[model samples]
Target chain A: MPDPILAARELTKSYGRGPDRFDALKGVSLDIQHGESVAIVGKSGSGKSTLMHLLALLDTPGTGTITVDGTEARSLSGRKLNGLRNEMFGFVFQQFFLNPAASVLENVVLPLKIAGVGARERRRRGMEVLEQLQLADKARNKASNLSGGQKQRVVIARALVNKPQVLFADEPTGNLDTATGRIVEDILFDLNQNHGITLIVVTHDHDLAERFQRRLYIRDGLLITTDEEHAA
Target chain B: MKPLEILKTAIANSFRSKLRTTLTVLAIFVGAFTLTITNGLGTGISNYIDSQLAAVGPGNAFTVTKTDASGGAASGPKKYDPSIKRVAAGGRPGSSQLALAQSDLDKIGAIPGITGVAPVIRISPDYIQWSGHDKYQLSVSALAGAQPQLASGTNLDDSSTQTQLLLPVGYIAPLGFADNNQAIGQDVTIGITDATGSMRTVAARVAGVEQDSLLSSSGIAVNKALSTALSQAQATGAPSTAVSAWTDATASFAPSSSAQVSDMKSKLSAAGYTAQTLDDRIGTVKTVINGIIGVLDAFAVIALLAAGFGIVNTLLMSVQERTREIGLMKAMGMGSGSVFALFSTEAAFIGLLGSVIGSAAAIGLGTAVSGALARGPLSDLAGLHILAFAPGPVSAVVLLVMVIAFIAGTLPAWRAARQNPIDSLRYE
Candidate 1:
């Protein structure tokens, strides 16, 4: 089989210190292969979001190892790490986090813009992804004016505009209605299966967890189960 | 991010809270307007002084007076000296002034590089009349040696034997001349009291009408022939000492640069003589005026400093309000450096907005005020604009405010840059 694209070992993360300290992630370990659709599910405070933040290189593990494509990313810091995260992964949060003042297209191209992509290429790529997400018509509309589903689509378009290897969606449909949430779920699965990009979703819904090829059930910062066990 | 992209975002972000940003920019406007106006005022007044200085004398020409001669303002009473002859100066202080006689002229003329010398003689005429009008006691001074500014007729020719005079506008009607133009070429007779106390009258053709200046307000400019004729008529009672006739001499040197002028002045000072550059005679008054202008400029700077604090306050609050937005950018792979640049650019944008609007408004209003003053309150003062603007200094004001904004934004931008994405995204 092909090498696992990402591997985490004994990941540990603690919030605060002293008596009031809380360990958000405790000695969790997992391996995800290329083009894998994986679900990390648990109840609130189950450390699923914390584990995803650590694995995505957005937060450092207190004590653990995370390697991406054979390079140890957990120890990396600053520009090199940020560059890796920007070029290798995309994130979608529940809040959407769009700059409401910016046009929808500007919001979508922000990642590529930060990547120093030229204006023409950024426009072509932004338009391409917006078309894929069926958001092409709303390109000129301000982000603030977009509906909840449309705003999430723009966020997804922004994430995919950079064409990273991994898409990390943390409660992507948490704020959407059931119809919009199902649509968003269908989009994430399509991106993983059709585009051959790895999808990592963090959700509390067991139904959504059943759709993933592999599942990691984390509880109180511990990984309780995974479909595969691999040191690599 | 490219600088242009960063700038665009900064600009867009600045107007997110339009009312708050406008209020901050308005604070900077007050500062920039006050600063630009004061700068214009200084420029205008200095330009006027420079034009007026050019009329006083040539670069190489300076008045040579006795060491004891007092001018402008002097402290304490002048001491009595047996050897220093007291000759009355035309517009100088003290009566017991040592006169510059023919011997002193020889001494000055003998100095190496002393190209030319002309004695400025003060002649007080008893009365001046023209075409049988009532004789009026008129003010008179001889300025045939230096460059003469004429309003209507030509300047006096030194070699011409015919006596020619320049009359001030105030004297045109009183001296029986129809107007400034009609007074030209009109002959006027000046009655001078001779050394023997007898009234002697001399006739001179009016060559020009002098433009009234603050220094030459109500005077008649006497030509060389008229000056010589009057001096000799009153020469008998004066002392027969070797250097006791003329009160002052204007010495001309070959080198006209200020550097060489100072060199010649030092040499003359060592010789126990006083030398006053046309600048020196008028420089003290210029300093006092500029000092007043400097005080005005300081107040304007204070206003700008206060505006700087307003910028700091506005930007700090922006950082607080944009906490989540900043975190999102950080999460999108923007380095801390890019984050810092974004906020700094935003502050600079606000500063640019305020200064540009303020400077533009200042130029608009300042020019109008200057024009109104010229035609109204300052009509008597010729060629004086109360305010002036230059492109370099005006642009500098914009650049200065931007720099201040950049400095003020650093603290807030630093806080934004150092923010942890996890914590900031978690911000409510």
Candidate 2:
């Protein structure tokens, strides 16, 4: 019954303009509570990712607003907004956006590095996170040399480096094998359960959606169904 | 990110595309190297010119002569007019034997702005010797405070009366001295024939040594007392044979400055005295050398300006290629100002690298070149450095390139800073 850590109301987003305009998110509203795991499920162009981006404050809504921890996110300056984003959110993408020239530890330490953490301590914390993820042996290996599963794990380590309040994953296991995908899924749930961090995942996988206690299903850019209600 | 952390990131990221960065830095290096060398060349030549000017004469004095007092052309080499001594109305090149009469001196001394007029009394000694070492007979001119370029030892004392002389470097070996330092304070004897055609000698201490120059050859210099003794010891004991209307008299002017020197010269000309300024002769030479140095500097500046373009090209490419990285950093809490600072810092680092390398190389190569020229082609112009590295200009060249690079990076950095985080992150 705690307040939603992240919530969006009547959020609308569109691509292009005039005749070419296409609404990616239309009046889609959702609430993600603190320490809760939620899944936003939709087909391609269904606005799941767009809604997630708005909730993460990476992009602004065209016609509506987003609020985080009771603050109107739309009213903050760019500097304050960026600082809030750094302090509150962590992200993992399907493609594994690791800098290939950097070492595994460096990739993990990037968010902390961008947060202005000192080098020695950032390295120490980065190594500790890597060790927790069983990636300590590969700390010095370049990101380019890592396997798909290892790369995803490295990306996840980077997402958790800042110890953000909420973790967002967009198709986190999309590029892994079935066995490796299961392990990655377990890790996401484990971090959610053990650390009590709010988890908002955008995905098309029914199996992944089935595991989350709350599921918002979007069709044609509008959230039209709740999985629990459907099951009832 | 903090400035220090941003700088660290900029430095690391600069090496991501090594070949491209190196080529850009090399282009900048060429520019900086040229700039450094040109500046040094100008410094070296100007230093020599300054030293030479100080040695030439007092700034406000000119050598005056009563040339063509009639103020008319000779039409040819006119025979001796008797009135103006050896020549007719106009003086010839070899008519230096003519002396200005006391009346003429009085007239020159009374000219407007003429503070004083001192005749250049010529003295010839049969031989100059030191410590039993004798040099051949030579002619010495007595010009107060006319200290020639010094190889060693102090300058001659123009007011001294005990008997002091400046020994030329060429006389060091002939005067039985190991070097100029040994000659200084040592007693030397000059052989002069008195008015009776009999040999008489005057003793003087060696005060300083003079370096010979292409403009003026090796000769002895004598203080006031020694010069008077030598002149009075002449074979006839009189000031001149032809009542020499002396062609060269040192004239002093009031408010001693170049502008006043010109004004004084024109006034002397109007008074029938041809005033020759040493600056009028040597100033043109310095101008020619400085003009050459200026042209060379222009070319170096052109090179640096061209290299500024290379910096722009390099930073623009970097910004384009790192679109995602820039976006990601923004998403991770880096403000737009930090993004701009990062790119600008990268540009400055490149500039620092190129210029430091260039300046160091220039100093090394310039010193070698200067050494070779000093002993070779530039030997006649003694004490000339073909290239000299002055610290101020060297540091300025480094700073100049850094500023150029910073300015060049602005366009690209601004573009990078203004990117929407979503758009950049979505960039493939």
Candidate 3:
């Protein structure tokens, strides 16, 4: 009944130009409601990754419309856009891009710090988030010294530090071992279950895709199938 | 992020690559050190000259004498002469080489605002000796007429001692006379030529030594010889030169007051006798010495300026090494302005540190260098001894050098701050 938390319509993304124009996302349309658990699954060169980037608002769509929590994504600029990114979406990447030299806590609190949150509130929130992830023991350790699963958890903590409405995970466990990868997935699902947070995941594993209540299968920048297909 | 936070980040990042940061800091240190020391020396030398000049009074005083503008001896005053022509030192024609008689001193001393005057009579080939053992020919530089008596340890009253006594202060020390302050009150002799071409020697006691001292090493042995001959001459009370007769007609009139003295000098000058003022002679000596010091200071500053390039190199390297860190900050939503401020503050810190180091080094070096220079050329000649850590000039120059270094750091900081975040994040 209510509007979806994230919506992408006729989204398209291309790299380079002319003969080299390679479309990463082509006319892909999807929507996920508040507190929804959705997954996009596809093989290599699929538009699933590009679709995730657009959904997270990390990269602008070349041609399409995206709305997150009722705000049109194309309209914001400068501080307004940066604030939107901070307040509306949290991201976990394949590489686990944590600032290596910073402590686990500092890494977790970086988003809030960038948003100019007061120091006491940032530390309190950071500690709470790290505790939730069972990373309180390692909060003082440098991110570089953490295990892969722990590092991914810290990145997740960073993403969720601001308590955003949408969590976008682009192959969050891609770089970890099978055991570490499973632990990261369990933590991701735990965050969804405990916090009732919306989760939009892009992954190649069919098992990961089947775990989501909704699924979109993309191939070669085109949407091949979805649980709910458009009328047209 | 707050400025402090950004600076903390920058410093931490710099420290990560300790060798790079140290090399950068060292470059700035050397640059700032050169700047401070050179400018300090320059300013110190200039101030020293100024103080020394002030001690003698205004340095603009000059004597007008009958001489052609070309410096040839003018037989008499002629038309179209520049009223304020300068009197060259020594025996140049239009120069003040022509002697000032007692009457000239009186007249000049009488001028209303005219501070003081001294009769400078030149006599030569007078033999001087110390206690009869050492002997040498001496130039009777001048019989300088007294002004308001200074607070001197030497007694100026005893006319019977030697009315024609030399002013011990004027003895030019030829370098390297650092020690021995007890040369005053010793016995010496002087021989002058009389009107009949007969030489007579007179014995006299050293009335007083000057606070201003000189040490000419080459002339020290000569001075010893002169002291002995002078002692014998003073003991005999005989004249040393053949043409020792007093020259001025008004030399007989002893002026009752300083005003009376000035009145006498003007009247004599109007009658074709050239005159010299006390200020005129002191100004001439002070000017020559200060000019030399000024030149030296200018050269030092130039050397420091050349060293400024080192600072630029260091800061540039700092920017290069911090590219990724800078990109990281930018990605955290810090605007270009905040980025610029962070770099600028870092530069200011480095500059301030370098300035402190440079100034300390300069003060130490200045002391040793100035001492060496003084000991070599001026110690015996003028008895001037300078200390290394002269506060006024050194402090001012330290501050100035810091500011310059701070300014110099800005360019590199700006370049670093302006780097594109996306591209910089990719930097190795």
Per-prediction TM-score: 0.82, 0.78, 0.62
For residues B20-85, write the lDDT of model 2, one tens digit per residue: 889988988998999899989988877776666655566566787775543346565566665666
If chain B of candidate 1 is superposed on the true chain B, what is its TM-score? 0.76
The local lDDT score (0 to 100) that residue B208 gets in candidate 2 is: 81
Q: Which of the two, 1 or 2, has more DockQ?
A: 1
Give the candidate order by descending DockQ: 1, 2, 3
Q: How many steric clashes does model 2 contain?
A: 7
Which candidate comes out best when scored by DockQ? 1
Pairs in clash, predicted candidate 2: B98-B244, B98-B245, B99-B244, B99-B245, B99-B246, B100-B245, B100-B246
DockQ of each model vs. true complex: 0.65, 0.51, 0.19
How far off is residue B180 in model 1, in Å? Answer: 2.2
lDDT of 1 by residue, A122-182 (tens): 9999999999999999999999998999999999999899999999999888999999989
- Computed on C-alpha atoms, the DockQ of candidate 1 is 0.65
Chain A alone, TM-score per model: 0.95, 0.96, 0.93
Residue by residue across B1-428, what tens digits does model 1's lDDT show? 88898998899889889999999999999988988898888888887776666544555677898786454565656667675566665565654567877777888887766888888766778898997899999767644454445678887776889988877777888877777889888888888886678888889899987766655446676767878887776664655562246778888777667777787888888776888877787788789879988899789888988988998899899999989888888888889999999999999999999999999999999999999999999989877888999898789888988898888888889999999988889899
The residue-by-residue lDDT of candidate 3 on B354-384, one tens digit each, is 6677677766776688778788976653434
Instruction: Evaluate candidate 1 and give its CAPRI docking class based on DockQ.
Output: medium
Which one wins by lDDT: 2 or 3?
A: 2
Mind listing the fnat for each candidate?
0.71, 0.65, 0.18
Worst 10 residues of 2 chain B by lDDT: B86-95
Candidate 1 chain A TM-score vs. reference chain A: 0.95
Better of 1 and 3 by lDDT: 1
